[model samples]
Target: MIELDGVSFWYRGRPDPVFADVSLSIGEGELVLFAGRTGAGKSTLLGTVNGLVPHFTGGHLEGAVSVAGQRTDEHPPREFAHLVGVVGQDPLAGFVTDTVEEELAYGMEQLGLAPQVMRRRVEETLDLLGIAELRRRPLRTLSGGQQQRVAIGSVLTTHPKVLVLDEPTSALDPTAAEDVLATLARLVHDLGTTVLMAEHRMERVVPFVDRVVHVPGDGGVVDGAPAAVLRTMPIAPPIVQLGKLAGWDPLPLSVRDARRLAGPLRADLPAPAQPEAHAGAEVLTASGVVVTYGQTVAVRAVDLRLRAGEVLAMMGRNGSGKSSLLWAVQGSGPRRSGRVRVAGVDPKELPAAEARAVVGLVPQTASDLLYLETVGAECAAADAESAADPGRCRALLDRIAPGIAAGKHPRDLSEGQRLALVLAIQLTAAPRVMLLDEPTRGLDYTAKAALSGVLRDLARDGHAIVVATHDVEFVATTADRAIVMAEGEIVTDGPAREVLGSSPAFATQVAKILGEPWTTVAEVAAAVDASAGRVR
Candidate 1:
């Protein structure tokens, strides 16, 4: 239903095209995944389907692109709205209405559908994406994951022939992501809708995708079955990487397949070494933390503590108070009742600038912290505000996410690039306590690895870090401690491996295939190497 004939695209003043000579086709009812490193033109490719590339984005296009018999070049994005439903990475930027129900119905209303038809589709979409409970909630009040679901439901209600989503499940928790992906699978199988998605978290989508399209950042595209394409792809899901490491032929794409071939390898591997405990002094303490939005209690009275050199991961279902707790602790969001003390000072009583020095926060919407035009300006401003070295912020940006142009506008950056910029700005402050909410939303595995290393180094440098996230793989690799929250309360707190391995919903692919104490592929690979060394 979708075809690209020798398509080459480039931005103004750039000599090299983002992608070149990309001739591809997607059969009707096919669920195709676009896999690549961050800023490797995955999102740019998705935009071409809905005519947002050359038309709205002001880029040069060569060759023809058509979807469902409509040429994107001939028609504008709005004209193809009936044929394509596109969801960008940042959902909040696309929202036009206040409440969940209204946003879901807005697309249909624009299509001039009958009131009854719009209402029926709205209800069906709400149920399909599992957002029926959020129908009455205001859009601003919902969590990032909730907003992501609402954004997808709004597009799904239109019932377009082709659905194009960029990082659809990036903000969702594990359970919610499965629900959304399962719903997409149903659409492909039962309703014959075509889905073209770009996601960094490949583990969740690899099993469900009918085909894989790998973009290798060299202005080329590789397309084939999952196993065929993953063999040479630089980045891969944990299951695929494990299969490769174990020398399993026809690399497994799912946990079930990996487990079937893991018996001998599991036997050969030694138990993973236990993580060392953090013995640093207490840096922050909070008690009776309560955050409320009128009748809604986002964060119940809770007590928490953080040491000087610890990385704590706060995890839970969407809208389960992770973000609320983070915001309250940072003294930015509503805290009806709470006392947060950092370095013997109450941040809530300090000015915003002073509070940031005491406790820095990189919010879920990382772009909110970036207002400067160019990346260089933002870094310069961050350095000036923090009274740091002139080039400190830029150096941090390079360390976190390399290759970002200093002159590029922050608004024009990819989601992952923007997130990295915000992180660099926050780190320049050198706050004693750092809090990040969903920091890995758009980062590729490589970028995430860089971030994980940065966090580890910061912890070693006597910085206390708390990350509120849904990326279980990230938590497994980065966090030293894990705290599971539910309905405005902390329900479980323990070592990261203990907490992640114990929960089936949050376990990593390696842990599932190789069993407990093996939550990351790196650790497993290390154990395998150790066993081999001993035998030699």
Candidate 2:
């Protein structure tokens, strides 16, 4: 259904092409995943399918690309709208309507479908994506994950033959992500729709996809069965890593497969050690925090305390008050009534600059913090604003996400790279307290590890950090404490291993296969290695 013949693409003023001679094909009813490191041209490849590459992005194209027998060069993106439905990384930027129902119906209306057809598709999509309760909610009022579902529904209503999604499940919680992926799987199996997706969270996708396409940064693309391609791919899920660690032939791609081969390995490993407790002094405190939007209460009188050297993860279903609570505590977002104190001063009473000095935030949409012409300029601005050393921000950027060109535009960077740039900017401020909402949205495992190390170092340096995210694996590796929120209130709060292990929905793959305390592949690998050493 999709074919790329000798395609090579490059931007103006760049000597090297993003990709070269990438010949590939996707059969109908097949679900293909694009796997690669951050900024390795995964999104750029997805854009070529819908003619957004050379047509709208102003890049040079060397070869032909076609979808469903229609050449992308022959027809404009609008002309292929009915044949291809594309969802970019940032869903909010693509929205054109105010309410959920209207956004879902907008695409069909543009196709000039009958009112009855539009209505039927709208209702079907709402139910399929499990967003029926949010049909009347304003687009701006909905959470990031809710907005993602609406964005996908808008495209799915068109009933395109080929669906191209970039990081489709990045913003969704575990349950919601499964629902969306299962719906897509149904489309492929029952309705014969072709899905081409690029996602950083491979654990959720590896089991669902029919094939894997790896876009290594060296302008080469490798396509094959998921197990074969992932066998050597550095970017992989914990299950795949665990399989490799155990020397299991034909590396397992899912938890069920991994668990089947884990019985013997489980017997050789000891129980994971309990994490040490945090003894640092309290750095931030919040009391009676409440955030409301009109009649809807987003956060309900939440009380919390943060120690100086703690990495706290706030997790829950989408729109369960994570982002609202973070904003309230940071003294920047809507807080109908609340008191937030940092360093014995209320951040809400201070000026914006003063507030940032006390509490810095990297929001869900990291690109919102960047507006400069080039990466170097943004880093420079951050250093100046924070009154730090001239090269402090750039140095931090290099440490977290290396090889980002200084001359490149922030908008042109991949979603993960853009997030890293914003993280570097926020860290430059050296605030006493830091809050990040979905920091790992577009980051691959390697990038996430770098970020985890950075967060750990910050905690060791006596900085208080709170991260609101749906990526449970990330929580297992980075957060020292975990808090689960539901309907605007904290329901569970305890050690990271205890909370994530006890909750089936939020547990990591390693924990799910090997049970409590074994929440990460690294932990299991270390335990096995130590056992071997003792025997030797």
lDDT of 2 by residue, 4-66 (tens): 999999988889999999999999999999999998999999999989998998979999999
Compared with the true structure, what per-residue lDDT tens digits does model 1 show for residues 164-235? 999999999999999999999999999899999999999999999999999887898999998999889888
lDDT of 2 at 470: 96
Least accurate stretch of 10 residues (summed lDDT) in model 2?
A: 266-275
Best candidate, TM-score:
2
Stretches > 4 Å off in candidate 1: none
Residue pairs clashing in model 1 are none
Report lDDT per candidate.
0.92, 0.93
Clashes of 2: 0
| Model 1: per-residue Cα lDDT at residue 108 | 90
